[model samples]
Target: MEKFKSFLKRKDIEISAKRYLIDALGAMAQGLFCSLLIGTIINTFGTQFKIPFLTSPVAVIGGTEYTAGGIASAMSGPAMSIAIGYALKCPPLVLFSLTAAGFAANALGGAGGPLAVLFIAVISAELGKAVSKETRIDILVTPLVTVMAGILLSWLIAPPLGKAAMSVGSLIMWATELQPLLMGILVAVLTGMALTLPISSAAICAALGLTGLAGGAAVAGCCAQMVGFAVMSFKENKWGGLVSQGIGTSMLQMGNIIK
Candidate 1:
């Protein structure tokens, strides 16, 4: 218990921020491969079975493909932001402000609008630090306040932005015929990359119009990535039994190929 507490204490905000940034970039690159993998799997299986999966919930909400990845990516960021804010002893209002800023920045950045998420994240984190007095009560209230603020802000701003992103997606799609092979390659590569990040493969599949096949491929890719990671970990440490054990469990759960 003491060792666990010490480990938790070692998780600094600066380190968290850096890790999140790396994850963001990795997610973007991996999104492309995920799309390709999903596309390929769908193409192969869709021929034999009628799969009824949707690529991402974001696509359902945004009414556009381009925003799918962003939406999926946003799902994890908020929770992480809230946790980080709490850890750093950010005030309730400040935590919410930071969340809002990060949400907006990520939303805008994913849609190719601007490179503002980093700046927003930094400012929000600093502001949170200033306002929070390092109290347990503050940590408890931070997520709630942040969530409310984020919801209000997103409600006001997301609609128009979503529409614009949809328009951009349409333009891109219209410019070329959607090719299955290309999509497959892109999805595979992206999925491989995203495995290291905190992004969703479902969103990438949606972006590529592989909604029906996303779920299956995602499960498979996740399983494959976990296996790969386990192998690598084992190679580094001869006593890495835990990694192999986890891989075995994940494989058992995700091995079934749909169709």
Candidate 2:
């Protein structure tokens, strides 16, 4: 339909980049909650927690043991997708439809799950957007079509793409490990720059499964940016500057830094 075409036109590559990549993936996906939930809390606190539920691992037949963190990690994909859908201005039906798509893409993509969620969620959102409010029986028609289409796409496309991304990420990670000294500094600097550049370094790290020495370097780089900015702006901004840069994001001062 003409209406569908118009809706699709509205969601050009540029718009998708802004809505999915910057707003949803960067700000919300890798923001405070995710950082705490999946990053620090799950990785640090959860590991240290002595609670039975938190520490006890449940074994699956022919599969790795499931822990609290693993469960939380599984949920991250859908959560990130919903955030993307909401940012893309999807209707309730469409947004929920993306949950299914996100789960499939993330699961299929494996270690590179978030990237898959981003890509599939965008496709699913746009498809849903095309049909949003197009009919009076939107409640029925909209959801039915969106969910079906999204699931179908997930089945057809998500798995192989996810494997490919994971494969590429594995190669990069292996390379980083093989040359830790040089790669560490490079990754740290680049990921640090990415953190301040209105992009999701956390997402990138997660997508690539960047761990070990390289991950440590990446953390150092992020800390350098935050600390460097916080210290530089101490005279004028004071505590606000500290909280914003040190505890918040160095990106807050991007304009002043650029100026």
Candidate 3:
């Protein structure tokens, strides 16, 4: 255990909640933004404006043609997994191998894909790192370990994780429908609070498939936090702060909020 801790320190692999939850998870959000969010934006823009190239079919796969945006959106899992690996400072091979694991987790996990990618990617990267440079044929061993771990985890846990996440999401949605007035406030407050934390509320929303009334409440909550921070800090931060926190993220104000 001492040796392992020493090794981790040598490799700069700090094992802490802040590292995983704040750093890696935050990076995961960027991955989500790049692949899923950006893709959704492209598709929506193309469709809404009827732009020719954006709307045009770029490629065909599995008997279906996909636009550029569709292709980008479809690769969200790989993108997110890679992002997590990058954030975790994984070795080159371990980082690359996460691509396969991410795809498997996302595909198998369905609505809970993001969460699966988060967990599986972290494990696979770490496992791969463990085997990395351990042998004369390090190139072969590292990738092999990473890919196998990712594949096995996807097969074993991805589906169940997806189901569990979706179940909670469904329950939230059902409650919102059944008691719109009360659940709305509850969801709003909770999601708003989440937005201000280091954790990714968007990832949680994506994992749980938060939509309909629940989705609206979540959006409202996010907006409230953002706007609240902007307003509260206006005297100290001024307009620049207001714009950044208001439209950007109240996350930056986390320190002040804590104080």
Candidate 4:
């Protein structure tokens, strides 16, 4: 019990801060690299392997919802979680904060915007770290509090903000017939550039409004491929290999699915 008590204590603040920064930066960089690599591969494949069945699946599953911002948000969780846990020796608290931040950030991003959610996550993590002490109760308390706060923030604050952003995005895309397709390609490239972002295809589809055969099919294809790629790249997952397969299969399926 005494030994356990010792574990709950915070380390030197300077050391803790340094370690936190390094871990966060490393995670962010890795996510960014993956996003760019995936984007490049998708663009190349789109041109070379234009087959509907093949590309459609990739597009549907491997769409560009996962942006760098999303990745940075996710990556920040583990770093902040562990740092708080070790520095304060309150595992539960750290874990809770991580969970809260992740959920809040993702939900916010999915609803429309990510910037506000990201800010909330960072602030929550920092606050959790400050309040935690070397105790099991503290661990639990930290995360619960953070999550609750995030949930409240997301529901009351993020939703309205996201709706407004979506409205703008919708207005921007509504101006043209081929706008959705162009938007899809642009988003796909961005997702490729930021591999850590989540399913962006849904937003694109919603924006496109299922107005025509081509637009609907395109959106569907993007969603399938994005999802498929995410599934394949669970951890340090190879983007190139999965993308190749995704492109081939998604395009092939598009022809059958579209009609």
Candidate 5:
């Protein structure tokens, strides 16, 4: 065990919950924001507000036309994979190869693509990192290993993971509909706390494919957590704290909340 730990350390692989769950998960959220979320927002505006250029089809893939936003949204899988690889500090070849793995995971994972990408990307990046620069044929060896591992893993597990996540999300949404008062409070409180933690609540929601009542409750909880902290600390923190915690992030007030 000690020898293995030393090997990992020597290779720059730090095995810790903070590295995988916190740092990588946090980075995953940013990737989602830049790709899926922003694309959806732009598409929404284009559709609702009747913006001409925003709605204009820019490209086509697999016989389907895509607007600017659609192109970005379609790349969510690669974006998430590369983001996680970047967070893990995978080498250049390993990182670039993650795009393929990420695409496979996201495409195969279906609705739960984000979670699949998270799991697969972490494993692939680490595996690639372990083998990185170990051979004279580093360029060829690195990408081959990373891409194969990613695609195989994605094919084997991404769909099942996606289905499982979507099922869980369906259950939650169903339960919320059946018992609005109870489930609403339950989701709100848990999601609110999740928002303040180092974990990525957005990734959680995406993995579960949360929507309707459950989605609304989660959003409400997050907003309340952020705004509530800002309001509570208004006197002590002033506007600076308000903008930081409220608009910026409720995670900023996590230490204060714990205190």
Candidate 6:
């Protein structure tokens, strides 16, 4: 028992914040940039903005014209998992294992898919990592354990978490509608902060099915963070900085801003 206790107290199991940032958040960012940001930009500018020939749907698949956003949305699940696995420092074999986990978690989570993938992927990675070097056939062992853990956890936990996330979003949306001035302020501040944080406000909004006042408020908040920072830092960064920070991502300077 004492030996087990000592083993439990070892630092190897302890996941530090820096590690989390490097592994988890970093992965999320990559996924978001590739799937969400790039996709959104392509969809929005191409479909909505009038830029002569450029403003047309990028491609046609399955009798449907697909904009950048549409393609990105479809690929979000796998992209998120792949980037996340890379960040988690997963071996090549285990990296693909996380991809399987990501699909299950995202699918089961419904609207709040990314968040579900986030939780499941991180846990599964750790579990897989623990047994990674234990077996001679690491290729077989790591992926089997990781994918199984991820799928099981997704089945057991994702539905409830997704529902909870949706519920919270609904409450906020309703509140925003009922009391635009008050709830708007609250949602704007909170969701805006969420946009800048490591999480995905778009996924949350979609999960919550937020629209009308709440959706508007969410957009406002995100714009405030993105454009606000870009404009504010214009003096220091110049036009290039404005384009990068504003159009590219306000979170670019998150660490520096925090400091």
Residue 221 alpha-carbon offset, candidate 5, angstroms: 6.2
Please identify model 2 stretches exceeding 4 Å from their true place: 1-17, 27-36, 57-69, 167-180, 187-259
TM-score of each: 0.38, 0.62, 0.76, 0.42, 0.75, 0.74
lDDT of 4 by residue, 1-259 (tens): 7653444344222334333333433332233234433444554555576744324433222464433234433343233233333433333555456555545554665534333344444445555655566456875776666677656666666666556545434533543334566755654443332222322334544655645544544555455565665455544446653554354222212212223
Q: What local distance difference test score does each model get?
A: 0.43, 0.65, 0.79, 0.44, 0.80, 0.72
Q: Per-residue error at 109 for model 1, in Å?
A: 9.9
Model with the higher lDDT, candidate 2 or 4 = 2
Expressed as tens digits, the lDDT of each residue in 1-259 for candidate 6 is 8775555344134366655555565556567667767777776686577654445567899888766577786677677777777776776777788878988988898656767887888888878767776789988898999999999999998888777656556656666656668888878876766666544466677666767777788888888888998899899889976876677566555444434
lDDT of 1 at 22: 46
Error of 3 at 139 (Å): 1.7
RMSD of each: 12.0, 6.1, 4.7, 13.2, 5.0, 4.5
- State the lDDT of candidate 1 residue by residue for 1-259, as single tens digits: 8875564454333445434444433332233223333344444454446443423332544454523334443343443444444444555566565555555644644442122333344445544443354567876555444445445444455444544444434433432334655544444444544443333333433575634343344455556666755555565444543343233222211212110
Q: What is the lDDT of residue 185 in candidate 3?
A: 87
What are the per-residue Cα lDDT tens digits for candidate 3 across 1-259? Answer: 9998988877667777776776777677667667765677788889999999999999999999989898988888899899999999998988999999989998898666777888898888888877788799998999999999999999999888877665555545555665788888878877776666543456567766777888898888889888988998999999987876776667556544434
- Lowest summed-lDDT stretch of 10 residues in model 2? 27-36
Which of the two candidates, 2 or 5, achieves a greater TM-score against the reference? 5
Q: Global CA lDDT of candidate 3, please?
A: 0.79
Give the number of the best model, judged by lDDT: 5
lDDT of 4 at 28: 29
Question: What local lDDT score does residue 65 receive in model 6, on the 0 to 100 scale?
Answer: 78
